[model samples]
Target chain A: MRGFGVFTTIALLIAGCGGGGGHGDPNPVQPTSTPAPAVTATPIPTVNLVLQLSSSVGVAAASFSVGYEAGRGSFSGSGAQAQCQLGSSDTLAVNDDDAGTLKVAILPADPTRAQNLALPTTLTCSFDETGGTVTTAGLRIGDKKIGVIDGNGVVVAGDSSRLDVR
Target chain B: MLLVVAAVGHCARGAYAAGAPSCADPNGDGVDVIDAANVLRAAVGLPSTCASAPAACDLDGAGGIDREDALDVLRRAVGLAPTRDCLPHLQLTEVVHDLDLPLFVGAAPGDDTRLYVVEQTGHIRLVKDGTLAPTPFLDLSRTISSGGERGLLGLAFHPQYVATGRFFVNYTDTAGNTVIAEYRRAADPDVAEPTAARVFFTVTQPFANHNGGMLAFGPDGLLYIGLGDGGSGGDPMNNGQRLDTKLGKILRIDVDAYPTPPSGNVGGGDPDVWDFGLRNPFRFSFDRGTGDLYIADVGQDRFEEIDFEPRATGKRNYGWRITEGTHCFDPPSGCNLTGITLPVAEYGHDAGCAVIGGYVYRGARIPGFVGRYLYADFCSNRIWSFVRDGARLTSQVELTDDLDPTHALGGITSFGEDAAGELYVVDGPTGLVFRIDPE
Candidate 1:
């Protein structure tokens, strides 16, 4: 009876420490009658990105990643909101609807700048959804955190804080 | 950043916070929250400020502050933008006066070194050897009306001006009609025989306004004359569409041969008609390198248009009395869907009222915009450029404020080129001449 009492106290202490109800014991003694059917779920793909400055004037480089859901499908190209001078160049990329990636480089006119610095501190990559508008994710300069930007490349609310690179 | 936020927040609180479904600030004093927010964002270096709130910083009251506003402040602060685009840069250097009263401006073939200007009262002036000859080269003001759209409207030296020393002028007669006349340098080489006036072609003007009054020699050596639509508003006469009328059309003539010479006229020829359907073609020029022709036509009410005629095409009809500038007139008659030429560049009356044609910069000084065509406005005082790639024309920039705005060239009567291919502007109202140079 002494031994049984000691065993009972030990069991109680273990259960309490584990914080698990009787159904979820770390070392369950239950042996399933039949193996649970193989659980199969679609895995979300991860995006990789990098920012490179062609003309160096100490401008910060920014990067970002986007996530796709089951119904969201895939993304196409990406864009950056930049203060570019006349004849400054910027590069962008994104995942396409078919899971492929699209990339583009844009050089806009900026005749006013003496140094011709093109600072695209924020970037947004988006993908088209099946029934809804395009889903977008953004990245501030030198950070991997994704946010939201409008169609015109403006940072929306809740995403404004993430765009501060300076 | 704090200022921007405060301003935006204050605006949002004053306007949108009121909770009016359709808010109306009667005095238009309510600040736009979105705009304020954008200003803050831009000032803070957070993404783009203008991309979202374009109207918040509309400092010029033009409804939105896009690149123009940004550029405006930057230009005012920094003097001028770079002259890489079509807009002229601020004159960091000195503003020199090569010649005043540079009436008519013309350049010699293949050379920009020599500049020729016509004195409005008659007589051609030359800027050669870095000095303006004190005497008149040719005197025809006595024969010219010297009135509206009259006097010496155009001057064109033959491509072989070095050999022939021959040139032509487009002026209005005492009858206020369009005349293409020819003249030659006198034996003294410095003076012109006033009696040496030779009538090339005379087209009677129906009214005072749309005489078209620009004469240019194409690379093909065909003399092209621009005649305006018989004047009066809305093209009441519809002379532009009529093939029989020389008014409102470009007349291409072969002036090398004489059909029936005027009794005292030294040079006479049947001036064959070129492309038609022009309304007050104030100025026109041939691209020195490609021979492409550019014509600037003044609009009646709504728009000012620039027409491009490639050297290869003949008898092109620019839409006049029909579609003014990519838009149909109020009544919309005679603006046919077929067989009408369109302008390469156009602007609204609000931006500029009249079009002043200028030369394509073939000069070496402006390397970035060498192939681009430069033109100006009479009222808005704006100078603009159009870059042609093959047949496509892209607008480059507006350069009004970049120029000396203190001297608002009320009427941009003509553009002149020096012996070195540099260009000059003649303001009719001020009788002042400005030369375009590199900073």
Candidate 2:
């Protein structure tokens, strides 16, 4: 019954997550576009948000997306390189439109987690912290609302994680 | 103009006009913006412009039509049932090598060339392009218990593994406890990311033996697991008839973490369990064709039995200490079979000491085994089968006569299938993965 789909997820960010003052923003990872060769943008001030899970209750699949206003920013692939144990059979998708948005998705190779989970998991993302009035649109765990953590380590319900992406 | 892929096979049911399949196109065709509009009317009980068929409309099976049925129809169109009605033979052909105490075998969805074999020593080996890969797909021996009915016990691939590359396993961890974990194939698609292991669930075992560990994705898409009564002899903990513990029961959970019941047929709504009252249901299988389940529970001192149930007979209690198979076990005189669901067929120690549950042959190669439930014994090392009509056992025969003894099957631990629905057999001692071939 829980559908953490693209549109539903987008709607969560747009409708549920509210914004705040402070030019701080969580830098999200931006994926590549068409045949345009690789080019790093001008250095932009960014804040990395690390969401820590209270329990590694087996995350089979997950995704996060947010929209903001700033000079385009992206993730540094900076935190916990192996934050999650993804299988060669798993799928990790990232989408960051140069405009002002970013999305991250990970699907595990097994759903039952018969091997137990990599407990106390953490998600580290990056984006322009100065993106004027930055806020989270949505965060999902296993396509369901299990809470998410802000860079401040403050836990927020997945469906209503309106904390400043900063 | 929107050309929808999910829109084609996935449609809204019940809301269709008379005699149609689903809501989107009614005729079970592609979807359009107005598809929801056309179906919405019928769902709300207002007449619909789309055609509706019995398969889509009469979903509740209550001999009536309503909005709930309409909503259910829509859910059904999203996921279709697997193919059934396959008749296989009751024979065997040796394949694969000393799988190292191979406990279970499974093929990834949509992948026909590859098969995964799980060994009791905590290693999962891959059989690709007709041979065992040099490297292990997974190695959990460092964390799993390796001796005496322990180690890796069960394996099941995600129904959508072709697109998900996911699979589940049941094993006894180093702590001497039962554990169910999930692992994904690494970037190589062949090897698993050992570090990516995540524990889905775990249970502390009371004893070493009877650590019932068998997992399978049900026809409903919910992950179904079979756990024994915490592994002691004669139900010492009385876990078998006790609903309080997960031991001696079959549990079901939506791995996607999505709401369950996929399409109803789930008779009980306990949310976490499907049935209970089993004694080391070491192996069980759902007939690929009918979605019916056949469970072979190991006995205590005298009997070995097989219990059969349809897709919706949820919350079943297969009389354990109270009754073994269909007869009285604990009670010497007056025992009741009243509320208890007895095994459809049972055998004595004279026939086979331990019942190794097999599958209902639904393969193309074995024309003879098409509708029969094939099973074997560990002590006698003999094979047997029976036919199931609805919930009853109609015929019983010893299949050991059909097989060639020269090619010892070792000790049958589990049976598995490939993407094409072919049959296979595995032995925990010799590690041989056998297939049912031409008689």
- DockQ, each predicted model: 0.05, 0.01
TM-score of each: 0.59, 0.56
Q: Model 2, B1-439: lDDT tens per residue?
A: 1111111111223332233343234434432212222233334443333333322232322222344443333222222221122122245677897678888898887898998999889888999988999899998888799889899888888888877778888899998899888888888988888853567777889899898888988787778888888876889888887776778888777777734433332243334567888998899888889888888899888888888878866778889888987779878447877778887777777766888888887777766457777787877667665677654454354445345334366678888888887878887788788887875
For model 2, what is the alpha-carbon lDDT of residue B170?
A: 89
Q: After superposition, how far is residue B230 of candidate 2 from its true place, in Å?
A: 0.9
Q: Report the lDDT tens digits of candidate 1 across residue range A1-166.
A: 9999999867766666655566765664332245789989754443333333332232222222333353544443322222211223432222222433222222122322211225543333434444333332332232232213345443222232333332
* Reference-based lDDT, residue B203, model 2: 85
* Backbone atom clashes (below 3 Å) for every candidate: 32, 51
For candidate 2, give the docking quality class from DockQ: incorrect
**Model 2 misses residue A57 by how many Å?**
83
lDDT (Cα, tens digit) per residue for candidate 1, span B299-397: 888888888878757566677777786567734664464787788777777766888889898777766557767787788666665567774554344
